[model samples]
Target: MVSSPSATPASALSAHAITAHMGPCAILHDIHLALAPGRWTSIVGPNGAGKSTLLRVLAGLQSCTGSVQLLGRALADWPRRERARTLSWLGQNESAADDLTVYDVAMLGRLPHQAWLAPPSSADHAAVEQALRATQAWDWRTRALGQLSGGERQRVLLARALAVQAQVLLMDEPLANLDPPHQADWLLLVRELVARGHTVVSVLHEVSFALQADDVAVLAAGRLRHHGSTQDAASHRALEQVFDQRIAITQAAGMWLALPRLERPAAPAPSAAAPVSA
Candidate 1:
């Protein structure tokens, strides 16, 4: 049900001096970001680092200071339906009604393009089917949401987002609950989206997975620590620092890998303790 915007040469999404506050605490602070067309950008940071808040702002779900632009136009200027059609969002812990079938839930992605009382059209059906197949969820189309396992449900949600077919996608922890194989599948789907000129921005806790992205943004204490290519030294350092230096980044098989460091054994207590007791 998502509608494509008129072709534009500008970036898919941009945020300038974005700041969000929750009562006495600030969730985001003066953040600036942009997602180029046909590219993948991963937001990586420690827990409570405001990555999720930034995604919410980009999705137009959270109010904040500063401006967000979609396809060169101010985000606030777009009609709700138009904006929804142009930008699709997959939140960190999205849940669907337990009684709804997978097919029915995926069909909701078309809501932005549907008339108030209009039933699903042939195009909608085709889009939903393609999306489900893309995410390998077509086989479970008729299953109730509650019947699926955690990973299965996550795939279904991804299918729902894909069905929107928006030019820009913002996903928060899309790999949540996914097995390694399914996670690989999700990565492939993202690459396909970018190949077709779609822009993607994802917040990921998996440092290794984030390394696969075309670019990475690291956040700390509600501020941007680094925003650049994954190969950039600053990005690597920020990523390492955010993780408390517990992870080591290395190139293996020409691919960047973030491996956790083995804990070092503690040194034996000094023999002087025995003499002190005597």
Candidate 2:
């Protein structure tokens, strides 16, 4: 389903002067960022900071004021079919018809590759099989989506996205409703994609998970506060400032961990040196 560009660019994605509004309430303000090819970038922010909104704008799912470029071309200039083949989006709480089998749901990703009203080719079948197996969702291929648990359904959705085999992938809050082990599996999947020369952008609420990304973009109050390499001191400072220093960062086992600062009761001050009037 992925589109092969005539030529690849130095940066896979870029956004400039993006501002989005929902019903006259601004959600993002003058955002500018560029994502490198074949790298993983995570967007992190406090709730209501418009992290997801910014992602939508980049994906062309949301109308906003600004320009987003993909593969050295303006995003708006791409044909719809070509765009679909070049970018795959996995949004939060994605839902499909409850009666659709997992296989059928995942096979929908092949739409971009299929001729209209034509039967799926062997290529489509192969892609779906690989995707399902990758996510370990093959075991339930014939099961209807409604029959699966939230985590299981999430896996199926992820498989569908993987089946697209896009050059650039965007996911919004993909970790929601996943257990710790499954979350780790998702992380591995992302790394494997990046290693294979796919660019990935995800919006993550988990600061620790975001820290594992190659780069992080921090947003606060609908504005971009910082965008830099994850290990950079400037990025860490932006994170703390955005969160009002409620969390602390510690490096352990070659990874950064975000832990909340536990509030403790203040001790009473001794009665003002008991007024021994000098």
Highest lDDT: give the candidate number: 2
How much is the lDDT of residue 250 in candidate 1? 88
How well does model 2 score by local distance difference test?
0.92
Which candidate number maximizes TM-score? 2
Superposed by TM-score, candidate 1 places the C-alpha of residue 37 at a distance from the truth, in angstroms, of 1.6
Task: Enumerate clash totals for all models, in the order shown.
Answer: 1, 0
- Candidate 1 C-alpha RMSD relative to the actual structure: 3.7
Give Cα-based local distance difference scores for all models.
Answer: 0.90, 0.92
Backbone clashes in model 1, listed as residue pairs: 1-110
